[model samples]
Target chain A: EPEVTQTPSHQVTQMGQEVILRCVPISNHLYFYWYRQILGQKVEFLVSFYNNEISEKSEIFDDQFSVERPDGSNFTLKIRSTKLEDSAMYFCASSKDSNQPQHFGDGTRLSIL
Target chain B: AQRVTQPEKLLSVFKGAPVELKCNYSYSGSPELFWYVQYSRQRLQLLLRHISRESIKGFTADLNKGETSFHLKKPFAQEEDSAMYYCAVLGPGTYKYIFGTGTRLKVLA
Candidate 1:
């Protein structure tokens, strides 16, 4: 079965530096989403993308955060400036449609110093 | 407020014993409920969906509208069933999912 793959399974970045988390969703999936789980916290939704535009986003997805489907298969989340609070396990997911069960990637563990 | 709640942070069950993971939610609209499992380092896998009403891996969950709960249950547990389970709810017209804190299931042999 096709699965969403994320790059740099683990990332360590210095504070105030820009970091982009990359994900290649399932080939035929149409909807993409980004979620983060801080240590000891539940997974929190960041944003959802479809049709080359953001369909919805949470308050956590502020000006500092941006998402782009740079290509047909790649969906990337960029954090303009890393903060200590940004350290978390970032998961990328995709689904065939809006109401379908989402398939998630292994996740990228981002550690901001 | 739209939220998903899993009161138990951890649950333990002996092999061949019955298992139940509780999940409760508060949503204004018609919500979609799903049970996702993560085995060790593996990614989250869709275990069951209330809408499907089908059993997967011997597990089943029935969504109760009046109680506002969707609890995952397995008639018999196995060692392989040890994993972290998360309950999530998606509200109508909302593309984002509200996830619960997650319950870590430890099936002892």
Candidate 2:
């Protein structure tokens, strides 16, 4: 079965540095999303992208966060400045449409030092 | 606001025993509910959706609008059913999903 794939399974970055997490969603999927989970917390939604634009975002997805679909297959999330609290497991998901079940990637573990 | 609640953090049952994972939601509008599971070292994957009304891996869940709950159930559990399960809901007109804290089910042999 086709699945969503994320790059840089794990990343370590300086507190003030920028980090970009990349994902390649299922080829035919039309809606993409980013979610994060603090070590012991529930998965939290960050943002959703469709048609090259953001459909919705949460308060957790503030000014420092940005998402881009630079190419047909790549969906990337960039954090302008990483904070200690920014360390978490980031997951990328996609669905054929809004009502469809979303498929998730293995997730990228981001660590801020 | 849309919210999903999975009351149990951990549940353990012997193999061949019946299993049920509880889930509840708070949403004003119509909600689309789903159950996602993650086995050790594996990615989170969809187990079942309320709309599909289909059983997978001998598990099934029914969307109870009156109770605002969508609990997953299995007639007989197997050791391989051990995993973390999450209940999620998507409110109408939004792409964002609200996920529950999750329940870790361990089917002991």
- Tens digits of per-residue lDDT, candidate 2, A1-113, equal 99999999999999999999999999999999999999989999999999999999999999999999999999999999999999999999999998888999999999999
- What is the C-alpha lDDT profile of model 1 across A78-105, one tens digit per residue? 9999999999999999999999989999
Error of 1 at A92 (Å): 0.5
For residues B55-77, what per-residue lDDT tens digits would candidate 1 score against the true structure?
99999999999999999999999
Look at candidate 1 and tell me the lDDT of residue B102: 100
Model 1: chain A TM-score against the true structure: 0.99
Clash list (residue pairs), candidate 2: none
Poorly placed runs, candidate 2 (over 4 Å): none
Query: Which candidate has the top score in TM-score?
Result: 1
Model 2 reproduced share of reference interface contacts: 0.95
Error in Å for residue A49 of model 2: 0.5
